[model samples]
Target: MNHSLDGQVAIVTGAARGIGLGIARKLKADGARVAIWDLDVAGCDAQRLGFEADHLQPVDVASYESVERAFGATVEALGRVDILVNNAGINGPVVPSWEYPVDAWQRVLAVDLNSVFYCCRVAIPHMRARGGGRIVNVASIAGKEGVQYISAYSAAKAGVIAFTKSAAKELARDNVLINCVAPAMVETELFREMSDQHIEASKAKIPMGRFLQVDEVGSMVSWIASPACSFTTGFTFDLTGGRATY
Candidate 1:
């Protein structure tokens, strides 16, 4: 059987670059019209993502008002939303829990965890009104295995995982399937935020002896956000390169 996303409208947060941009490319290639939401819309090339200028918008997912307006604009311009990729996130201060700054910790949770709830809260009503939709949260293997020196990032992602499962149950009968994609390590701009020691250690932990690619993660997300993904919700898909034991 073939999976086609013809006529679908998707919103990919943090899509100005990295994994989010990669996902937008794949989704557009797969026949879905995509909208990018981020703080600065500078890096996004509508031509590169095969979208029009109107599809890109500046949005701070951490702010409820920003999310609501951006989502409303998307529906107004694209017609209706069929998929949402919650990929906006940040890797806060890399320090032991005792040494992590309070502000950094709070910001990480606000962006990485609470933003998911905010985006979902605004998007779910639109989705349910449309009868169905798909939501794929971009979590991390750290959320599951808990990496050292990045306690805030690890905890926020774990919250995302838990929130996904709980939200799935709440929306089970509504036809809006929600799930998570937990990738171990990927080569992207996000790497610049990590220390050399941390990056090398992460790569060493993956049994495949290499980091995952952005396009590979994109492919997983595209499918999960398609009708082909029906019947599975609240599930966590791993892109860990053989490091996941469960």
Candidate 2:
């Protein structure tokens, strides 16, 4: 497939590292001007070393004002936004629903779900004016199937899946496409930060017997955000390494 994104601009949140970084790099390689937004202002500089000018910003997806301000700043810097990848999220804690922390639970939902809404709410208008745009959200397999623990993350991701569908339907008339990817376990710094026993257990559950690569997820995201992904909208593409049968 010819996945060239020439003359396009993409916004990727949580791009200081890991999957978000991978997606930004892929978009740049495909000729799109990329703007990376993350809360880690310090880390972003190191990651922005060789990228083109005016493409990094400190965006706190969990805050409405922050998101709006960041988006505004990004537009001033990158011209327009043609693609948005709502990838900023957190796995709050491994706990049952009954034991979930109120604060942590809300934080997870705010970032994982509300962030998607915030970006779409802000970017859709620009996209409509540009004639069309694409949105590819980073969901998780936990959203599809309830895991033993981590109820907060599972619930938050599930909301992302549903939001993608509903938003796609509303935006389709405007030629904006919204889709999501549900990856089971991926090899990212996020995973490495987890406990070794937990990581091993998660890997053991995957039929592929190994964690998915960040680039693999990036490739899927790039396709969903590209003009090549015309027919599919409000859909979930699996990247569970054979762990998901549905």
- Which candidate gets the maximum TM-score versus the true structure? 1
Which stretches in model 1 have alpha-carbon errors above 4 Å?
Answer: 47-54
lDDT of 2 by residue, 77-147 (tens): 87889999999988888767898889988998999989989988898888999899999999999999977
Question: How do the residues 1-246 of candidate 1 rate in per-residue lDDT, one tens digit apiece?
Answer: 457889999999998888988888889889888888888997567566545544888999999999999999999998999999999999998899999999999999999999999999999999999999999999999999999999999999999999999999999999999999999989998888989999999999999999999999989999999878889999999999999977
| Residue 56 accuracy (lDDT) in model 2 | 78
Error at 157, model 1, angstroms = 0.1
Q: In model 1, which residue pairs have backbone atoms overlapping below 3 Å?
A: none
Alpha-carbon runs more than 4 Å astray in model 2: 43-50
Question: What lDDT score is found at residue 169 in candidate 2?
Answer: 89
Cα misplacement distance, residue 176 of candidate 2 (Å)? 0.3
Instruction: TM-score for candidate 1, please give it.
Output: 0.97
Residue pairs in steric clash, candidate 2?
A: none
